[model samples]
Target: MGRLRVASYNVHSCIGIDRRFAPERIAEALLDIDANVVALQELGWHHRGLSNFDQFAYLEKMTGYHVIQGPTKFHARAHYGNAILMREAAHTHQLMDLSWPLHIPRGCILAHTHWKGEPLVVINVHLGLTPWDRRRQLKQLVHEIQSHRNSHVVLMGDFNNWKPASVMFKPLSQLLPECTDQPTFHTRKAHAPLDRIYLSPGLRFDTIKVWHTPITAKASDHLPIVADISF
Candidate 1:
């Protein structure tokens, strides 16, 4: 493939910064990003208000992309999960349960796709909000990435990391050299870099930026970060 655009977004369960629930808004922002690969977080399955609607299906239809969802846990509805969206059909997909003891379960969804006939591994994650729990999640995250077969590894999603220099990411940094420093949370203010993307050495990024717009600022609590990559 030529230069492929990839994006990471936390849809906040399709709820906007205005505190209104609207999946269409999220879809609009996705369309605006127009990325080949999208890593999404906070997608509910059978949530109370969303029991009648299959969010994963709706998003897939909206984007016209294949989706692989990994729900973290089952609660009153669905606590939510991470999903990877591919521009075309995915070659293979797997879900890795990254839940730790006494913590709200979290998971990662890995999708194997091809670009220019070369294998690309995309891992989507929604890490723990707490520092202690996030540390454990990072340890597990490292192992999951290593287990994948593809060498063109691209990892992204809500890391929930407040401190940009958090030591928890040291292990991940070794493999995916680029540090996720772009702020995406609080769309209106854009104060934190909770959402991020990382790419392996083989994949080079031509341009990367947060897709912050008037519509996107209200579409979700977190903005979408897009990167144009070249192999």
Candidate 2:
């Protein structure tokens, strides 16, 4: 394929900023993007937030894509963390346990996919909250992504880096000469650039936009970042 559209969104576990659970709204937002692959963060499974719904399966059904759920921790009926939804079955997939030594649980999903005829790796991450934790997580994250050297990489998710110049991102400086900052956090106002997508070498970018439709603003706390990319 010449280019595939990829998107990243923090769905806030399908809980809207208004405190209502509307998985359909999330689906609508995704439909608006019409992406080939999506990296989702802050997703919940059978956990209380989902009202016992299998959020992973639901998304797959809604978008007609295969899902790879990467749970950071298990709960009574489900787990919560990051996940990847691809247009086709993943060649391989793994979850990164990003829980810091003594901090909250977090994770990323590594799903190996094919775009056009090239092998591609999607690192779907939802990072830690505290500054201390994020620093360590970044280093660990770098190590994780670097291991898949032979494939074209796409790192995208809710990074939660409040500061625009966070040193925690230095580890990936070589890859981010130009970043797509659409300010996705706090969808109501959307002043924070917390959700992002980074593409590796040889991949080209045609468009980078925020899907901020009315429904999207109420679906989650963060708006979706959609990127039109090609290899």
Summarize candidate 1's per-residue lDDT along 1-231 as a digit string, tens digits.
577999999887887777777899888888888898899988864442366466788989888988887877655656467788887878888888878788878888888877888888888988887888888888888887777535688898888887656687878888788656788878878888888888887777789898988788887888898999886
Segments of candidate 2 deviating more than 4 angstroms? 45-48, 176-178
Model 2: lDDT equals 0.82
Candidate maximizing lDDT: 2
The number of clashing residue pairs in model 1 is 1
The pairs that clash in candidate 1 are: 1-116
Q: What is the TM-score (0 to 1) of candidate 2?
A: 0.93
C-alpha lDDT values of all predictions? 0.81, 0.82
Model 1 whole-model lDDT (C-alpha atoms)? 0.81
Structural similarity to truth (TM-score) of each candidate: 0.92, 0.93
Over the stretch 1-231, how does candidate 2's per-residue lDDT look in tens digits?
556889999998898988998888888888778888899987875444855677778888898878898877666766777789887889998877888666878887888878777789988988788787778888888887778778888889888886646677876756643467778888889888899888777876899998889899799989999999875
